[model samples]
Target: MRPYWCVAVAAGVLLVSACGAAGSGAAGSGGPVKLAFVYATSSQNPFQEMAFGAKAAAADIGGVDLALSAPTGINGPQEVTQFLSTIHNSKDGVALETLTPDLFVRPLNQAADLNVPVVAVDTAPPAGTKVGLFIGNSNTELGKALGEEFVKQVPADATGEVVLGNDIPGLGLLQQRLDGMRSVIKAKRPGLTISGPFDSGSEPTSNFNNWNDIVKAHANAIAYLGVGAQDAVSLALIQKNTGRKFLAGSCDPDTSALQAVKDGYVFALASPEHWLKGYVALRLLAERAKSGKALPTGWWNTGSLVVNSANIDQIIARQHDEGSRKAAFKAETDRQLANPSGYLRPLAEAN
Candidate 1:
């Protein structure tokens, strides 16, 4: 995501005025433990899913005063400000979403000093950040899966380039995804050349324009792969509008991206299952708040889902509402609780 300077006053207004708090009364006579979910942006499908999952966890746990805070767009400083405010407000715990983990190192470490548990969501925290747990997909593995799908669709002897785009050019997670895909394409299809991990802008319009230009410039590319949801939507639309017969696939999902897969315009989607990241992060924090226990320190693998024609309908059905999502994720949640080790990987293995 592109970074923008969010005004300090604007950050305050969002934290104090716009934050949505949900709860089900008090826990342990503390008059409802205050927990906050802080993300980069609220005006996107993935973040909305995350908020729904966090709110669902609060509702399920009961007595959690869960507050959701985010800027309307990608703003790292705003997220850091909001997170520090959440901690200073005597919040019981926090679930933080950040692609730039270094921005939060000091604040997260301070939260740990105050005995406030913090869980990193969507992206893992960097070393010395002191977050108790990370709840997200194994990004490198997810990228490999997407790569495998692309390889499966294209012939082994294909000679043209497979252009790749990284929506957020410098982010570690996106880079890992690009690297993972590169490794597979290089190893499996020696005849095919991988073009780029280009700076495909994070915003929709720019992302589309970047892909459109790339597609036109490389007319005979065998495939156009992206590592972000916006890329998926843009590539699909470009494929339809230009009538290009190139293969297209990407990481994550949205209504338009999923529909592209369903319509056969796009080949598949590698969903990080964003909702599960929020759900697991909040649940772990809530348990820590209620029981006065330290959170499990490691990577909580919320896992990934590869959506193709075979399961597109099922994946679409699961996106209807919070109830639908919970029902769909129940089995995995049960496994998380029953066999935590199966899902908890070393932080080093998160990428």
Candidate 2:
């Protein structure tokens, strides 16, 4: 995902002018609790699946009304507006996919004032902000996992160019993933000459065009690493057409990424358990709403894994099996509730 900035919250009186809070309402005595979820961007495949899990949880676990909302695109200001509007109307608890942490802290604190539980998903409260619960992955670890894959696939004494790509320059989100890849590569295979961690947009043409130019220039590049799903898929297509034998490492696995992995074009893709993310996050918020509990403090690493020829087929098959997926999710959710500390740990604990 392409992110804009990770703005830090100022240490002062929490401002309220920007985040709208004209009037707030709550459930009546012995009444159904109303809950909500807001995303920064529209329901892409991954996020759409997340909303599905949340709604399914609401159906199974009753006494709560689930309302989901989000802006069409990456409109940070509009997302804040929608979030405020959502919380204003539906009052109880909320799980939000925070685009800009700075824009959210004020309103989130406002929700806290109402005694409404707020859980952060996709992104989290910056350091020192007293947000009790955060649910997401250690993307840096995911990057490192992919780097390990690169070292395993590429020879130790290999000498060639490495073409890497990213969408935005200063996006705090992608930057972490990029940094993770760079750190791993530098540590494991310092002999490789990495080139063009270039600007790659989401559109297929842009990815293809940018990588096409880079691959043409550096025909000796041994492998290609991309920050997002599109980057690796585009390279996969290019490699197929050109019949080049470069190793490809991708960040996420969309259908194309999976197909590339199934074929020989892409070697490996690192992933944060996205399905687990949605189901577990919703379970956390729902537990907060039904019971008077809050999410645990510190980062909840969803865990990361590498997918290659050995596991891609099984993984792709599981993605289609909703029954099995939900069952696994339920088991994980039950385990988390039984012992959240066991399921998650501090960021410092991860490799």
Candidate 3:
């Protein structure tokens, strides 16, 4: 029916198609497994970085199509809504940052009923959610680390003020961090006077204003625990207003915050290995999906590292030259993965 040349070309195309289908069949011997990563908000750089890392890691693994999405805002209810939508849309597996576990538990269970592996990253879901795994640092341990670093920097005899700037008042993770720091401070240094566990509010501008007012009122304060990006803005404001420096610590890192660490404006930053968190979450989901096994229960604390002035220069240089904070993240990830049992423990167990 066709010319000789055309017939030969058609035969070749058919052969190639057959071989490709066979290869795909061998690769996905179990079933089709899709992965979706949903974040609290696309606007925050931290969540965006996590999404990027997850997508990149998924690319490394065969038979994975990573769909990274996020809500428009940081509201917990909105996060829950986005997560539920993602679960409904996902055909295979899903990974999400758990801002409000209570809100998402029932929906997550419904996904689990459909045999979709669900992993929580960045924040732990509510207890008894049957979540596959939690891949992030112990928030309380991070808080304690910040407190210890602050105490180390402040003068022992100085009975100065210390303030903790918390962005989310009701969040369990934030409360755990504050408690961890407060407990350590109470145990180690009874002389240090702690001030208002001031609510920094969610918005950056609100945090900036709150910190500005706090710094003005308590000029003698020696330390602050900033829980979010506004921490950097607060540090900048402090430098502008007081003309004096105090030990500044934060739960996470930002470009400006890292720069502050380099400039000696920030005393310490507890940088979590979020890249590894994303990678592990995806890898675990992929493995579980392939094996037809239920996802592992309990939390997997990925871990965090404290970066200070002594090592800030190297961190900054790595950030500037190599890539988007991947080097530091890789180092931390390697360390934790190498000794998972040693470092990856619950907050209560960490102490």
For model 1, how big is the CA root-mean-square deviation? Answer: 5.6
Whose TM-score is higher: candidate 1's or candidate 2's? 1
Model 3 local distance difference test score: 0.66
Predicted structure 1, TM vs. truth: 0.90
Candidate 2 runs further than 4 Å off: 1-31, 127-129, 203-209, 321-324, 346-351
Local accuracy of candidate 1 as per-residue lDDT tens digits, 1-351 = 221112223543332111123333324655666788888788777787888788767666666667778877788888888788888664688888975688888988889888777888988887886675788887888889998888899778878888999988889988888888888888888899888877787778899999888888888887899988798899889878877666899977798999999989889999888988888788777777767656787888888889999999999899877689989988877677667788888887788
Return the clash pairs for model 1, or none. Answer: none
Reference-based TM-score, model 3: 0.82
- Find the candidate with the highest lDDT and give its number: 1
lDDT of each: 0.80, 0.68, 0.66
RMSD of each: 5.6, 8.7, 8.4
**What digit string (tens of lDDT, one per residue) describes model 2 on residues 79-162?**
778778767765766778855777877887777777667777767665544566677777777777888888888777777788
Each model's number of backbone clashes? 0, 0, 0
